[model samples]
Target: MNRDDGPLFGGRAWLPALLIVPMFLGFAFLGVQGGTVIGTLTLAAVVVWAIRANPEGPIEIAAPGEGVRGGVLVVLLAPIDDPPVAGVLAAITDPSRREAGEPLLLAPTRIGRLDRFFGDIEAARFESQRVLAVSVATLAAAGIEVEGRVGDDDVVLAAEDTLRTYAATEVVVFAPGEDDDGAIAKLERRLGIPLRRID
Candidate 1:
């Protein structure tokens, strides 16, 4: 963010309540009483769990204490705001090309089938697919492996969950544009694991 933007946003604390008001009002005003009560309670509980579970800043994980040969280095590539799954696919196929060879693992974190179908139409899909295909032919050119998955409640939360599950030693990231700090901060908090932001 530009230094001139000041504190970025105000009332960061009440922001959730403000956003949820519409949902609350809509449920209450257009009631089917029993269903509304159950749904509202469920929504509120999830919101609380999600917020309480995330971290809140940029992370810088230390190098692994174990031998490099035995350690597992993971990179959680967040989805592109522009919605091109290919970079993700390509990155997963080979992340070592980036910043001193960060042993890339393309984390699958995206919407359901509807989004994937729509994705096939994007030009980025072609570019990513092209890069992915070529990268396969030239695995010796760069050592990278990619695997995909979907249905991470939140990519950040899912990434964090994976980290703990895998006991990852270090994490690498592909940040979207220049100064996308808020999104970065949200991930840091959600994952609670520090990360190194890669270009």
Candidate 2:
């Protein structure tokens, strides 16, 4: 339906009556006795004011699909770093120079933390949850609230289809460097919607 169809009132028309009662109280306080000229005028003024104030109803957020209005969705991607920390360090002999060599594979942070806490099923899930929490925290710190819709998952062609199905107005993607570039290209090709990368 078009916006001109009076906004799908859904019982909002009674709002004016609600305001008129308050106006009557205000009029009584103003020494306008028993709903007379001044009292009636006050009530009319309030009703008009109330009618003009159009408040919107809340919309629900759901998975992307056809016939549903999708909202802005943000997806964050974190890739593993190469030669992670805690690697081997080569030191010098007493009189010689120090030589640096290949890093010893450090115990994975996700593994260490996961073993310390969740006791294992999938370490990847643990890391994903950790990253999602971090992403939310970072976004909030930067004054960007994820009020509309936000999700975390492996973004693929199906993900793009889901986004289009839900008819999202805005899609926020969090990919770093080359990953972000790749995501944008894929989204552009598949959804034909503009992809905005957040630093």
Candidate 3:
């Protein structure tokens, strides 16, 4: 879900109510047989719409051509100090060819379910900022320049949002562990651009 669209049914609370009101009206006016049919059909429609609007679904991204010189977008899934930063640096900068500009480091806010429900994301944002700070400082100390920004809670959504403004030829994800194979595969299929994962 793009931030602009808000959370599922966030601002558009009226939509579900609108669909539900007709069912009760049918129950009051029509016979049980007719009301049951209407209610079932309405429920089915809602289910279909929800599935279609799912944020986990693949997003459309432009593929960069091979050997193109462009910016790199680095997504940091965990805070890194030194050891992991070396791997991240290796993934973003190729010894064979020079990249276009400073890599953009994005850290997604990882909020808990309860925090998200209550719209209290300050802690999550702070954590993400800290991740970016540590990663950026580590990279800088290693003599590599980077730009950092906090992203959306969902990694895919964060990457998609970054790509809108950053002309990235490749994307590098710094996952905490090798267990993120499923997420890496999903990103590879959806991002379209070249992707490298460092765990």
State which candidate has the highest TM-score: 3
Local distance difference test values of all predictions, in order: 0.45, 0.42, 0.75
Tens digits of per-residue lDDT for model 1, 1-199 = 3433223223255555555665667667766775477667767875776666533433333344454321233333443333233344345434454332334343434344675677543443444444334434343333334332332425465554454434444455555455333544566554534456654
Q: Candidate 2, residues 1-199: lDDT per residue as tens digits?
A: 3343344344466654665675576667755565466557775776776588553322222444555544444455542122211011111101132211111111112234445575663665566666655544544454334322223233544344345435444444545557633545565455544445544
**Better candidate number, 2 or 3, judged by TM-score:** 3
Weakest 10 consecutive residues of candidate 3 by summed lDDT: 61-70
Compared with the true structure, model 2 gives a TM-score of 0.36
Candidate 3 per-residue lDDT over residues 39-74, each given as its tens digit: 999999878877776555445443445543247788
- CA shift at 110, candidate 1, in angstroms? 3.7
Candidate 3 segments exceeding 4 Å error: 1-40, 52-70, 87-91, 94-100, 178-181
CA lDDT of 13 in candidate 2? 65
Pairwise TM-score winner, candidates 1 and 3: 3
Candidate 1 global CA lDDT score: 0.45
lDDT score at residue 189, model 2, on the 0-100 scale:
52
Q: Is candidate 1 or candidate 2 better by lDDT?
A: 1
Write the candidate numbers in order of decreasing lDDT. 3, 1, 2
lDDT of 2: 0.42
